[model samples]
Target: MSQLLRRGVLVACLALSSLLLPLLPVSTVAAQSGPAVTTDKDVYDFGEPITVSWSDAPGNPKDWVGLYPTFAGPPGGSSGATLWDYLDQGDGQTVTPEGTLTWSQQRPGQRDTWPLAPGEYTIYLLVDDGYEVVASTTIRVTGDTDGPEPPPEDEWPANPSDPALSRKLRAMTFNIWVGGTQVKFGSIVRAVRKARAQVVGVQEPGDNLERLANRLGWKHTFTSDDGYTNLISAYPLSAPKRSDEYAWLRFPGGGRVAVSSVHLTPYPYGPYDLRDGASTDYVLFNEGTHLEEMKSRLEALSALAEAEVPVVLMGDFNVPSHLDWTSATAAARQADGEDFVRPFPWPLSMSLAEAGFRDSFRTAHPDPVQQPGYTWTPGYPPPIGDQPANLTDDEVFDRIDLIYVHGPVRTMSSRVVGESYRNAHIRVRPWGSDHRAVVSNLRVRPLYRR
Candidate 1:
């Protein structure tokens, strides 16, 4: 009788234990049947946004998923001070009700959007109420890395390029990608001629500024051996004073206007050059550091603006103006789509503004909410030309190519010039460059008492 009773109790206990197993933590119950988590790409550009996908993830309060710095440590997330990029003390993230991590799950950390520097890192989905990681994958962070408001009823000028104004100077800034090799060169020449601007500046002008100026019947001055940037004037330009980074030109007839065509550090160094080091500043909050680290550069340009002649500085400034980074534009872009990047004031512009240079485009188009006036990329999807697709779907179409003026300058109009498929600007045949030209008509006086 005693033996039979003991056997019955053992059987009952076994049955109860099997029933209780289903109620334990999810990590103990589910076996990872597929890829636990993975990024779409193995190697990412310096600031590239990643798409991390996973087959299953639980939305429980005791679980979480995050990307952590692995350094030269273990990939299993087992043996290091795994610094999670997020400050999430919450239960779950990047997990769906249907048990999947979507493209949108590749979100940046809240504290530092640019979390990863150029190095190796790992992603982990954890379950010890936040201590033990159940699944993990690795990713690489290769590189480093606007507007406005308004409650006003905007009144746009019909003839924004007001011709009636005297002392008006028209200036055009062109990156002329690869010295205008990307597009038919003749088209660029024709476009410049058609604009009839007194001042023209080109970035990456290559070793052909003199010939190109001759072809356009414009006087040019860029004595530097680097030949990366050139300053041309319909009015004769006194030989440029050269620097390792820029060229200074003088237009005595055009009210003693001093001009400089500068090509600042292009990527991994320029202001706001995060994530692809080109058109991707909006999403990252850390872009200001690049500009902050380059204060000496800002002062040098400021000194030029304060020089004897009123300055009309132009080039692929490689930095956007502060006008595009107001609280108003941020609110507007919040609903633009999942891919839209959040923009910061890109500190270089702030530096220039503080130094007294006026952004001709912003001066003319005061309402950034109304006139974004993007000068990079033809438009989203690049509707025409041999235009290439953007590095990312969320790539920012910014106005980095700029023309800034100082010393009592008034902007009458500023318009972007290029292929007019979507922008409706005057159409140029066989688009001549990757960057559309920034042409601004301004009324100004010479501060130089020559």
Candidate 2:
């Protein structure tokens, strides 16, 4: 028999074979070669195009692949495939054994765009246009693809003409990786001095907060028991609270601002999990665990939010802001070849915003596409202690370190401080820490005492 004839016979038997597959032992199927289908990526941002590749097809012109939502059940002719195409053009009777099909705004023979919603989907390689699956695989499409909020407009003035109207409070948030012991401690001191930050929130400050304060002749410093979060200010700090270290900043100019420094748990991070095809609920649950732990701190901040005083919360949040990870920005990044980010409402950052705090960097530079302001690491993979060496390939650089403000404070300007000129507004030579620094200039309204 000719190869085509044998393939035709095999194609005819495929439907019968599929009916018996459930009754046969699993090993029987494992031993046989069959038509196979796969996607280029297991996960994709919503609205991003999808590509389905198949091999070992029966080569019948009628053999086709159908895209279906994972829960849509077995491919039935009446069920209707979300998108499909014949192995060969509809007119041809011969098909190659292997080929690829892409679905974007439209596919062959389809005029309307059928964009897959955010969820799991299945690709089926069926026999002779019949609903007998020869091989199949799953892929995830995720993102908030609807009603993208307009990018925020820059609200700060081009240049403050009045000294009184100019921003007076300069705050910096830095995760000095392992207390700046990663490099010369002096490098950390110089970074703060050069930024000219009046107050600084320091994360992972193990005994280094005081050392830094001493070097700068700063009188006040607060450190947590776990050595995870700390604060060092040029003025004095009062009413130091625990569980994320909330303190009262007493500026010499007679202004008091509420400050908190926090370093939330980093494991089971949402971006990594989401990229690995985890469900949105699972990602939100992971971040919710952190928020549950910081409930007291959040409540206190909420009360502060209701009060008349200016409040500043800063540190390594270990999570991305919902403002930065919008549907619009996800599409923007995918256009530039970074495809993992999606519109995820990270609970911690969203909760803070709900409590009236604003991301200072984002407040100054509202267009996420234009100013990503990534502060998580100047060096990808970092090559640092205890971090997995494979991080270079898996990690997404993000702006986790932040200085958030609320009440009578307006962000004049915010910029990143890092190891290089390209990523940082203020470059510090031989940057001491893995995470970059965030500095924001704020115009503060004086406290009104009754």
Candidate 3:
């Protein structure tokens, strides 16, 4: 071969070697991995602030961590939308890696707490590394700001000595289910008259105030923009005024006792359609507005009760006082300090407990059954049962109706008239209303004397 041809071939070979060297993976480039972003804490009280942290992703860091909140769920499942925007994107309130991110309890002032109900929420961290996302450990947020303190026990009149006072002051909470066509006016009249309750706080009475009061032979006092209505007996009651989430009824029992009747909207657990099955998300959202309004009203009522007189708050809270497992996914998502607004029940119940009022039903029966009781009865539509089957053994559904007492009233004994529709051993009349009446025997005593 000629020398020139040989040189040309050598040059071509050298060029090919350089190209192959560039194609080969470089040894200095290490595969990136590390401990996931770590939160300083897992659970936090609603309204309180919290901070989260993480070891920087081992890569060419492109952007700070962005947050997308899910309403709590199993990993890789159908989750809700992102609550807040990217956390560190200079959005005025961005949290630095060293600086802590704070979140308030599910109450007034907090951004995400607007539609405060009670439930869980999950916080997901997405680290922007230019090439791919590096997610951190999931943070769980709970709306239970009040902690584990149980409601105050029903206090019977400090001075049972005052028998006359005890007998004269009677309190009760009734959910009239105004939406139901079967809720006859006569039945409500019969229920109130039979109970002989002096100050009654009723819920869902629709717009039939005059007719209901006339039929029952009682004077009407309170009403709300929503269908919630209330009436007080025994003393000349003042006109009803709207408060936090109720129609406040003030009765002059020498000192005064304020009775609030409320109808909180249901919580939303899922999309509008899946409400029949596992859709607590939808229920929380639906009911959040009512809960928020009720919270505001209750706060006002609390202030009034503190200033003027003792309070014997009673009404249909329309929320079960227990942890719900089906909505746990949604509940965890609420924990992340995101700008998402959703509804939950536990948070509201926690707020009420913190406000110094006692749940009369819980106090009356310490170890009440955890399942649904007293409120829901079949016949609403699909899923809840269309026709009434055996009244006995039928699942007692939805413990939404409640009676709560505050101030100086001593709760002696409280029970649901038809707590168990089906007692295998005994027989009783069917519950008058879809919601069984919650009756309590209270002992009222003058403050300071006892």
Candidate 4:
């Protein structure tokens, strides 16, 4: 009996030692490999709240976390983009492992109205260890509301009649001087509607684009990097495809119209000190050529205009047109006196014409003699930044701003729209810019798309 009792005690002691193996210090293991994050739900209704949490985050309890809206791909380069919407107060707040945050239906700021529009957007969970984005993940949400409503017609002025537009479209180019601060924004908006242009482009829209888009009730609006130009339309606008010299908007629907807006190097000579005189290689290099950037861009615009889809190239060219500077036209404008330089085909205009685009204004006018169609001034005495030495009252007043288009497009009617101070047409209010606006009505040859 004694021997059997000792054997039983030894067996029990061995079992107890085996149970202590896992509790040893070196034997312990972490619950996770690296930082991991997740959301409670993949989708949610508009204004619906969501919970975001992180796990396996090997860090101090007080680590920073942030939430932002991103497009797609890893958190770098083109594949990834971060919108202005940031959920946190600043970069983020410190929190513990398995920390959580809530995304309410409402985002901060005036642009963030609750019940977001029904569009797919990505939510990014960014863990920043003070200096950089450590780990991240994304959640997508489709808005659940009928989009925004347009202001009543009575609220805004009515659009002008266009009985002539059966196959073509009208495009307007307006340089809203100083970002339209010179005149009432309503006046500009009303002027646009009166022209009844389907597509409108403006120079110097600056930061006021959203405000302009809001008032005009345009479905689409695009602003250039420097706010030098913008394109607004009633129809949907495809994402802008751009280069430093130009930006193009693709109009999607039955047929696409690639609209390119450019504010070429003004004077083309300010930086080079040659803007005041003629150049050696007139074609390859000209002081008035705007450092040849204008010619280069116009060439690019021409190539784009030649694409399968029709293209509308418009803007304040700042350089003279080849048609106007011709010996014949020069004789006509001789009233302005023999100008500084004899007629030489400006490279900017020559390149565009060669690329297959005709001046919409000239096309509609046919006779430059009857209607010089000067776009430089409308008699508004507002000071201009580009007042140069060679440009006298006559040369300063010549037509420079232009609308160029290629393909099966015909100008039904084209006219200058602006204040009547010095214009042939009756004065229209809201024309405060030193330059007048060009309104061109064109018939686009129907190109049906599936």
Candidate 5:
């Protein structure tokens, strides 16, 4: 009995030792093998230098680190680096596995003075001069100074008004889907008020135009016979003799302008067809019909365009702008699912441009790469239709709703008003509509008849 007891004790001790093996010191095991990066501080005072440390990196000469403002788009070279430094300090020599580098606005090797501004920024350890980030960390710089800090790098200068242009106007194009029946109407009212838009061109009013205008206390409202398009304004709007597409808007100071609200056919949307790998010829063929529809609406206003009468056309065009579909936008597949639909000369916008109309949002923001203002469905109430089963709930995002300006109107400041600041240039909570709204601060010059 004693011999059996001793044998059992030995067996239990061996089992216990095996169970405790993993709990031993980490030094007894191999270190984790992969690139790792961290900043000495997560937050810093304005103008303070930043120190980033890294370890277990590939150590290639091209392996580098970049500091980018969070609003500067993705980490790739598309936005360009605010500050960058290679592990070898651009000496074309390999570097050690781990080290530290500091940047205080002026990049190490460059002579130009690129001061690190106060804002949220990210640090990335990338390899081979590419966007393949081995590791990354985020840091914020607080504006601790007494005076106010400047706007972010992406912010457009506030209404760079041309000296000759003085009559100020704020206009908006909103498509309150199905009269915003899905959400509370007060939210829509709040959205318009938040935009501070004096003149609004509305689509899908759906018997709610009067209610909306009454709620906002706007004096004038125009609704198409078919209820497809509508207009509401603080200024007086004279109904044209026999037109549903446009109305004469008279400002308090005697400036006269024409405003049009149009909702183009949503059937056979060009962006989705393009995404389905449809040929350019097919897409343009469909757009040709859209072009005809647009021609019919603007035909009566042709002389107005020629006469340099300021006309603001706002609507859900149901198509992306030609200016947005460029080579720079093509380089980045937005959010991974969207296809590269660039260099596409969308005929509708091209026709509008030929008629001397400029996209108000694009006029305010010239760089498509810097700001791809996607005002289409804001990734809510996912697309539902006879779509392919393989298609995800949220697929494509493009700027389909638009505000176009003709004649003497100058788009001063333009921004997208949507559910959140992440999705729009301005945030109007309880966004109410699936499609975001485009609002522009415009300066309209008075038209003097010859």
Candidate 6:
């Protein structure tokens, strides 16, 4: 029994050692975790379903998984709370898993459509194994595409014989908030049509030019390929051009009245580069490149300003009305014959003023006491339990929205609409654009007649 038993035991021990040696590493001995779930699509278009799949593990499988949608502020605080949370539960359509571990889950099906408004949504999948959530990358649901076509050109009333009546044109510059469903095309269309603005300058259009123009029955011209900022008017556009800083539309009204729509380069006070930077204040007062671009554009625009045709420029300038201490000190230092630190004061507004332009709002209503208007602010009440003091203090109390006249134009009245301090009961949500529309009545004396 000695040699035979010994050889049998040695064989058994060697076999056991082979198995146990591989399992000695703590990393290898641990049981395999849940399956790795991945989604084929990062973004889901409206009326389209997303299919998700997983890498199967070599073990007993779990049956169920859960999905949740969450939201967050944009990179630069552009957005507030997650809008998806407010969506009705009925809006979320889901599919239950048919089989266990090794199976794929197709949401809605290939033909099924997810009817969600345009936004950035994330879908989270939690496997029944109690493992951490397997998340699909953020999916952006962009607005539905109707075909693209050139905006319609419409006719305008003939110039009046009376000089006083003919020169008078009512203009409105509005910053339509395109971030959400709050102030949509329907509301804006109704407002613009009712206002009957001869020429409307709009900001933050958000690629909805076609929808907006069609809804309002007005013609539009956009600055970018993506159509972020646009000009919608009853008059025909001559030639439209854009730079890094601004977009200009040449409106041929007798003589050429060039309308410049600007979205200035944001101030570079924040930490990150513009490409990936996030900030509480994304409103740039001066972009170095944008400043040069605007300067060049303004020089070009000055040529269009003839004695006969007046150029009226208006939009969100993203700069303060007057020079601050930083600018004042820099100017003084330069005058003293010393190399001074370059001042980045709200240069755009000041540049326009230097280029023989006048601010119409200041001209019309000289006193700030009479019309204390602040345009940019979070339109809703502060979140529950938050202080009203905090709310009031957080408002962008500066006057960045301005209407400027370059050549021969007189401002009869320029005031911010819908600002009533005495009546705290007024709701700004109905007229809920981020900017208060700066409306002005300009008197343009015809160059030929004058």
Q: What's each prediction's clash count?
A: 9, 0, 50, 4, 0, 2
- lDDT of model 1 at position 186: 88
Rank ordering of all candidates by lDDT, starting from the highest = 5, 2, 1, 4, 3, 6
lDDT of 2 at 92: 37
- What's the true lDDT of residue 352 in model 3? 63
Structure candidate 6, residue pairs in collision: 266-284, 267-284
Per-residue CA lDDT of candidate 5, range 123-155, in tens? 888887778888888998776223333233234
Q: Which is superior by TM-score, 4 or 5?
A: 5
TM-score of 4: 0.54
Error of 3 at 352 (Å): 0.8
Candidate achieving higher TM-score, 4 or 6: 4
Evaluate all candidate structures by whole-model CA lDDT and list the values in order: 0.59, 0.73, 0.48, 0.57, 0.74, 0.47
Q: How would you encode candidate 3's per-residue C-alpha lDDT over 1-450 as one tens digit per residue? A: 999999999999999999899889877867876535556676555434545555544333233443334343422322232233244434434334333344434322213433333344444444442313455555544553343333332322121111223623566676666632353456566666666666667666666655666666766556544445465555555543444344333335444455566655432322211322334443444344545657666776677546533456666664555422123323443354321312334445555665656666667555433422344543222122234543423232445567665555567766554423451111123334556666667765433310
What pairs collide in candidate 5? Answer: none
User: How far out, in Å, is residue 65 in model 2?
Assistant: 43
Give the 10-residue window scoring lowest on summed lDDT in candidate 1.
Answer: 154-163
lDDT of 1 by residue, 1-450 (tens): 699999999999999999998898765467537337666888877656666655444554445556644533333322222233321333334334123332222544332334345566677766534556557788776664322431222221111122122466788888777767665678778778767777788777776567678888766655446554477777655643444334444445534656666665443322223322334333223345445534554565566555534567787765666578556776776667422334454556766765677788877777877887777766323334555633445455667888877655568888878777365255676667767788888876654464
Q: Mark the 10 consecutive residues where model 4 has the least summed lDDT.
A: 267-276
**Which 10 successive residues of model 3 have the least lDDT summed?**
155-164
Where is the poorest 10-residue window by lDDT in model 6? Answer: 80-89
Q: Write the per-residue lDDT of candidate 4 for residues 1-450, one digit (tens) a residue.
A: 699999999999999989997797775577756666667887766557657666655454334444433322334321213132223333434345565666564542222223333333444434443324555655555543332342332242211122222466778888777667775667677777777877777887756666766788876877656555578877666544455444444445565566767666452221121122323232223233353445665656556545544567778877666566555665665665544434544555655665677788877665666777787765454433343222234234567778877765666777887665456442466455667788887776544542
Which digits, one per residue and each the tens of the lDDT, describe model 2 over residues 349-418?
7777767777888877888888989887666324334543223454577889988877777788999998
Which sections of candidate 2 miss by over 4 Å? Answer: 1-167, 224-229, 240-245, 380-391, 448-450
